[model samples]
Target: MDQQTIINSLPLHLRPFVKQQRYDDYTPRDQAVWRFVMKHLSRQLADSAHPIYKEGLERTGIALDHIPSIDEMNACLARLGWRAVVVDGFIPPAIFMEFQALKVLVIAVDMRSVDQIFYTPAPDILHESAGHAPFIVDIDYAEFLQRFGEIGMKAIASHADLEQYEAIRELSILKGCPQSSRQEIETAEEKLAKLCNTEQAPSEAALLTRLHWWTVEYGLVGDCEDYRIFGAGLLSSLGESQHCMDDTAVRKLPLTVDAVMSPYDITREQPQLFVTKSCKHLSQVLEEFAASMCFYRGGTESLRTAIAAQSVCSACYDSGVQVSGVFTEVLCDAVGNATYLRTTGPTQLAYRDREMLGHGVAHHADGFGSPIGHLKDFSRCLSEYTIDELKAHAIEIGQPTKLEYLSGITVEGTLQEVFRQDHRNLILSFSDCGVTDLHGRVLFAPEWGTYDLAVGSAICSVYGGVADKESLQLFKPTPRTSTLRVDVDPSLMACYSLVDRLRQQPAGLDADDGSIEDALLAALAQYPNEWLLRVEMLAVADSNLQQRLLEELRQLGTANKATEQLVAMALGDFPAPHEDRPASA
Candidate 1:
């Protein structure tokens, strides 16, 4: 989204709302409150917020000295054909929408003392004007809000329950309870505590409320590369502002509608944040949502039905091959169609078969008798031993295979003594034992020579020397190997190859020493034969580089799992700020 264009297009009236003058209208007390709030919130913002939000404050011309007057704000907004109105208190949903249709921004003018920060039931001037007004000047943001208002009005006109509309809107506004008076704040907080204690509150409402508190109220922006703050709630608070940007406890994830809607607790500093690439992207998302609802009154399914369906891709892995490292998952679900795939777990691998061999264990062995061939040959094989079979084997051999003999082994026991010995010449062996030699080969050794026996006997005995020459020469028959082959999904192969290459490059290549495009190309090249066509398709889809590379990949039919991950890597997540909630007592 073009932020500069949005800024350029903001109506003259609304421009003032973004300026510091609106805050100047504040009374001495209001100014004191603003200063106090700013001081605290600013501190919090510095810790967890996006840099854009701070920029927004600078753009809005808000200063630490005063409370902005509604009239003065309205005057500034008037230039952009926007106006701010003082509300008696919480306005009805109908009025809220009506104000939006008319392009008049309504903010409840209330204030809280430092002592009263924990509880409030009425929309105070701090919560509304400070929490919401600046974004009103952002053209795309203003459009988003207007569209939201329109959709909300339509829903109301259609006789959709006012409660549901209120609930959803509350999810976007009212970070927590807003009080009309000190007494009211105290009473409302008591009620909330009772409700929480009783556990009778609707879980969905609680979830939505928490989501609003976190994202709309205190959400942060940026990743490791860069970040800024934009949420109104954060913009208005002093301490929260600093805490959000610097704290280590916070967990940040890329923004998604589901993630935004997810529940959170607002009483303390947030442990996580949902980040978007930019406010413009968020505005576009909201716009798309509004449009979607207009077209599909019942919901998203109708849209899905209208579009051609894409085939779903599934990742397959070998059973015994443990992937004990981090990997990425990408899922694509347009408004109407939804599908998900994950590439996470132990003993699992996901890759396009065409670009690389199917998921399997690598093997190493000694000469022709080595089981390395078996590992390389078998595709998608599971090493299984039924409890009964294991028991039988234990009875016959006096013990089942020790944990040391197993690949990806987990077991509990102790080996007392070495029973067998064969030392004469270098010996080769094979077993279904699931052990790997030094060459990344999966091998099975059958005969227990002194050398092998000592290693397998127990952890303590592993270093014992061979007793005799005859104890070292053990042999086993060469087992027939069945080669396993898996077809790689060309697109995935290319992506993985590209990522791997980029990871190997010197970190100083790009300005940040990181080049997403370069990394992508390298990952693709790593599996040249398998992903050539896929790479070509991706390049063609993204030929203009106008859309996000991941989005373009989706358009080119790349697996959602891979694309989602690549996008996440490009954009990092930051923790949102915490909303001030009423104390339970």
Candidate 2:
């Protein structure tokens, strides 16, 4: 089957979600992510992975230069009687199984942002194209996958199963969202916890999917003592793939249908995995599974009995530790923004555990899963101390402590505290590493002279090294806090800084300098998504600079959605409507 044929075969409801893999749609960042993950994982997986995985990759012609085109991949898959198609992100388990049954692979269209370089909760090109697709070329393995899918589709699941699908999707988006605050992610996790602990038992389909997840997604192959990577989940992950092989603590058990059907959490690392004797043994196990599967023999009632006996899977919590007045805990997961279990109460010093994952916390409440939203800027309240006070505190704590500044730069310091007086904020601190901007550019090193960085502006490090940290044209303060903590990209920050500075200067035309706007235009070349941020910056600029920014926006043309929205905003005249701006743009 070809791309269109595969789409046509899918249920009409699912067809709209399937899209052509527009190879040109990928950006430089996407390419870089693909290259970085592959470069690191290739050597690690070479000896550890099933031999066919590397061979499939070579035959498919995926390389470091760019993302593979689906058409090209299908041409290779055709030889093995398989085809590949791209999906928006994650699909329903039934739809996913249907694709597998039809000998079609579903690749996620979006690539994870750099912030989630290690692992993304969502399936990406790395997991789909690079991980699962490579193994499809092994004819016997492919046949086993197809048969499993065929059997899987017969399993019945309730509507409640879909809740987890939405929860995970929302969690992935929130993690990658630059604007999402720490509190927001925690709240989302709490909601997910409630859904996971629902009174209803998991359906037959959900049970089968769990089995598929453990084996095909995160499974290992060989004896319990020794194993190789065959699962797509490990094969795609740079961290877990290596960790699974190197960590002796990770339990590897002999493959069995019962072990594979056991419940597992998507959030945390696997404490135990089922390992098969060989690739062919996988088929043998599936054959045995089919004979006993509820889908074929026992039906939904038996699957419900199994689900009722299974324990609820909850996210693991970070080891509790208190630094000064701040108490922090992280909800452990395989990847993405970890939810923090924080408190500002009296500190209790405990031995912090090294490996925090897999030790499941209580499902209902208390400890890690206790009600969230109690702590707010737990570290910010103690910012009142002077440099001397901070140094004393650091010695008392016995650590290389640091403090965050209102200016968005974090400095190496000791016992510092916060004071509030009207609107303006101040911090008294000392530093040995000196003060560095949000972009990691050293603004004040001991040997290096003090330098002020603006958007699109350049500076030399203490070692005299130069890189691409440009001064921005804007500075939009986040709603949750006073003083910018600067979580946004520097390019956007530079654009924000530009317009902010201009707004402070003069509103109308200024003859002082056009270089500021010129510099902004140059910076915008690489980061086109900075267009909306630039638009916000333009509102603060003088009339001349605003016009110049508009002209630059026009010059950018409608190359992509970001530029297209920018051009539309420019043409719409001054004061672009906020609601009209595309979220992606």
- Computed on alpha carbons, the lDDT of every model, listed in order, comes to 0.39, 0.55
What is candidate 2's CA lDDT for residue 18? 75
Candidate 2 accuracy as lDDT: 0.55
> Which lDDT tens digits does candidate 1 get at residues 1-585?
122333334443333223222343333333444554564565555644544445545444455435666555555666556766554344444345546766766665545542334333345667676667666666766775666555443321211222333333232233332323456445545545543444322322233334345445665556534667666665665445555566475566776656535555545556676676766666555554444331223222321211211111112221211111111322222332112112222211212211112221121111111110112222311133333543443412334443322222222123222222222111112233344433443333334221111111111000001111121211111112111112335655445434334334554124333466555556445543322223223323333332334343444334444334323322222122367999999
Candidate 2 structure quality by residue, lDDT tens digits, 1-585: 467876776655456557777775665445555655686678778899988888889776566446788887878888878877887666666667767888878888777755565668677887887888887877788898998877765454444565666666666667656577899789878877887887776666676777787789988987877778899999988778877875575778788878645788777778888887876888888777666544344322332332332311111112121111122332222342222222223211111211112211211012221111111233322323344554555522334455443334544533232222222112122234365544665545645322111110011110000011011101121223211111435564455556545545655325455776566556566666445445555555666556666765665555555346325634565643256756775
Flag regions of model 1 displaced more than 4 Å.
1-27, 39-63, 117-122, 154-215, 265-268, 287-295, 298-585
User: What would you estimate as the lDDT of candidate 1?
Assistant: 0.39
